[model samples]
Target: MNAPAHDNGRLALMLNELRLPTIGRLWPEFAERSDKEGWQASRLLGALFEHELAERAKRRIERHRNESHLDPSKTLATLEFGLLPMVSKAHVMALASGESWLEKGATILMFGPPGTGKSHLGSAIGHALIDVGYRVLFTRTSELVQKLQAARKSLQLPSALAKLDRFDLIILDDLSYARKDQAETSVLFELIAERYERKSLLITANQPFSGWNDVFPDPGMTVAAIDRLVHHSTIFELNVESYRRRKASDKQSARQRQLPEKNQEGGTTIMS
Candidate 1:
């Protein structure tokens, strides 16, 4: 072989032996292009890999959360323009500042009517707490009651309550959405009793203390639950008008209105 041809062949073999990805090596132009655009090739690749890994991790986390029957996605961070009491925010920040949920049991009760953003605030706090590496569990009141009932039927009520005790903060959203019987009350009280001083709880309700008698089905149990929950709980009564009502505009209502049409027998029918 000619000397020049031999040198070229050796150089090609060495490039192949380098074992860089074909795109990263033979297509070095793309790498330079990415760099000329003020982007780091390695960083871009790293970012892509990181994003892909994070996406996989997120999917796995979502699956585990689903299987655990606790929805972390319901937290307040996901709400649009969420608002919480100024003092409540300070208290919440103080709780999170402790760097641990086990430091002290801080319970929050967000009570208001429907569409009042109670769930949003509760869920956001849960998310924030979880972000700080605290074990936070979020579930609707109805769902929690149902699970408690099932656990009782299986003779695992204590275990269920104990598991709840493990959470740094347990967020019960939408309380009083449905009525609860005495049996449910007993089960719920067991949970509260177990976590009395061990963990924190965040509750969002559509009803106030006065209306809770309808939920517990007995004045005694209602008082018991309220006492345990409110003993060290931070009660935030969100008395603002329903968010849905505030968002509705008169022009929107006018546009949504329907014109009246003359029907048979000369009677006008409003077509809504």
Candidate 2:
């Protein structure tokens, strides 16, 4: 027998009040299906609960992705893994799972020349981790350092750092650009120190450790920062041709191939 109209209205009201929007919208169709198939009450309840949980997980992932500020285009699926021969796809996939290392607050340091896909790989990792229910934040190291510096001047540096702690991982892209002066590097160091062994960091830098003296003002500060990051860390040195340069060269070659050729009489002839 069909539920009375008043009973259905009351159930809808109760579902809305209880904030079960997904179930509320879906229950009528499920109820019809259950009636048609003669499903037991337990099965109907289990189905509803499963759908509710699934929808909740989906919404949570979407919310986290928006807040992550990751480039939507950069993901593991879109990355040209073949070009980065030094980076093992198997290893990256394992890290992307984010089960073991992220929980331990391990760091991921990517060292490479510009346009070599360091930033792309870092962003891809962030996207992958987010899919597994970890919150992430992606920002240029220089931009984040400036914000921290401003927070420091306003006496809200701790608050800023605390806010960042909510993210399971923070990806600092282009770290070499943040080596402006003492104030900026100090704030950056504080961020590194604050998250040490507590939250994960994924940093991409154009310069290797030997060239980091240019990044940190003092040698002692440099050592401390490196020690904190390198401890329990996974390092990826991307020694590959610049992706941008290769792409441009490929485009140029294709255009040259498409250009019309001159015939023996100097007249342009289209090549088939």
Candidate 3:
């Protein structure tokens, strides 16, 4: 039998007050199914709760993903692993699982030339970690540095860093773009120092260790930053040819093959 309108309204009110939105919306349908199938009270109640929990988990992930600033298109499935032969698929899968390393506040450093898929891999890893319930923030190293510099100028640097601490992992893309000035590098170093051994960092850079002096400006600071990052880190050196360059070459070849040919009479003729 269907619940009376008054009873249904009262139950919805109570559910809303209790903040059980999924259960509130679903219970009516489930109640009908229960009656039709002669499901016991316990079984119906369990089914409702299972759905509520599942929906809550999904919503939580969506909220976290929105806050993460990750590109929805950049996921492990979309990553072109064939172009990145130097990177081990198994190793990336292991990192995606985020097993023991994330808890230990490990780091992932990706060093590669421009267009070599470093940023794509880093963002893919970020998406994977978020799927497994880790909060992640993906931002350009230059942008984050500017924000930190602004916070420092306002004397709220600590508060700013604390806000970032809530994220399980922070992916700093294009770290080489951060200007090599004391003001900018100092705050950047402060962030690295604050998160050391407490939270994870995933950095994508076009520069290697020796070239980081152009990023840090100070020899001592460069060493310190590299030390902390490399301490418990997994490094991926993407030494492959540029993906963009390869794609451009392929497009050129295709266009050349599609071009009209010169016939015996010296007139252009379309390819058959």
Candidate 4:
């Protein structure tokens, strides 16, 4: 039964005021059932709160996911972990499930050749973290360096870093793309130093530590950045073959194999 007009209107108003629209809109039906069953006040109140909290959580997850700036297609369901023998599914699932390591500012460093799905893995984990309420930002190494460099020119580098501090984890894709120049490397170094042990980082790179000199201007700076990043981090070396190449090869082979299977039995076989 519908609630009385006055009760419906006033209850809706109260729900709006208290920011519990989910429970407010449906409470009238619940109220009718409660009246029928003689549910106590505490039970009714608890039901309302449970709906409200569930809605709040849903909204929170959406908000975080939108703000994460990650590839929407990259998610746990999209990643074919079986093809990547080097990747440990257990470890990645653990990291994705729990926020302790990310919240405490531990870094995840992923290294691999191009097309090896390093970026995919990084973005997927980032989205998973967002699902669990961790604020994450995905950016390329070059783009972030350019942003930081521009901020430095305007003397707002500190302000920029302050803004970045809001995210729980920063996914820096293509860490190997940073140009080997003082101006570029300096800003990159500053960014690393600022987040050192203060915020979590997820970095994808094509180069190993010994080859990092190509990105940094000097050996000392490279060492410094490496030291801070590796101090509390999980290094994932993705040595498997490129996923793109493998996928393309599979498609080609499928087409090639289908050509001989249908000729004699099929209704039509075109000949020029």
- The global C-alpha lDDT for each of the candidates, from Candidate 1 onward, is 0.65, 0.90, 0.90, 0.86
Q: Model 2 — TM-score against the truth?
A: 0.89
Model 1 has an lDDT value of 0.65
Error of 2 at 97 (Å): 0.5
Q: Against the hidden true structure, what lDDT does model 3 obtain?
A: 0.90
Model 1, TM vs. native? 0.60
Candidate 4 per-residue lDDT, tens place, 80-187, comes to 897788888888989997558865788999998998999889988988888787788999888988899899999999999999999989999998887776346788
Q: Estimated TM-score per prediction?
A: 0.60, 0.89, 0.89, 0.88
> Could you report the Cα RMSD, in angstroms, for every candidate shown?
9.7, 4.0, 4.3, 3.4
- What would the per-residue lDDT of candidate 1 be over residues 1-272, giving only the tens digit for each residue? 65443454565577467643342333445545666887765866665456555655566555444543444554544544434333355565555444544566757888888876677666666655555446677787777888898999999988888777667778787777747653465666677777876788888888788988777757898888888888776777877766555545534666555333224336755454
In candidate 4, the residue pairs with backbone N, CA or C atoms under 3 Å apart (3 or more residues apart, or in different chains) clash, namely: none
- What lDDT is reached at residue 111 by model 1? 83
Q: Write the per-residue lDDT of candidate 3 for residues 1-272, one digit (tens) a residue.
A: 98555688899999999989999999989999999999998999999999989999999999999999999988999887888889999999999988988899999999989999888898898899888989999999999998998999999999999999999999999998887763477889999999999999999999899888888868999999999999999999998899668757878998776654335346756556
The candidate with the higher lDDT, 2 or 4, is 2
- After superposition, the stretches of candidate 3 with alpha carbons farther than 4 Å from their true spots are 1-6, 247-269
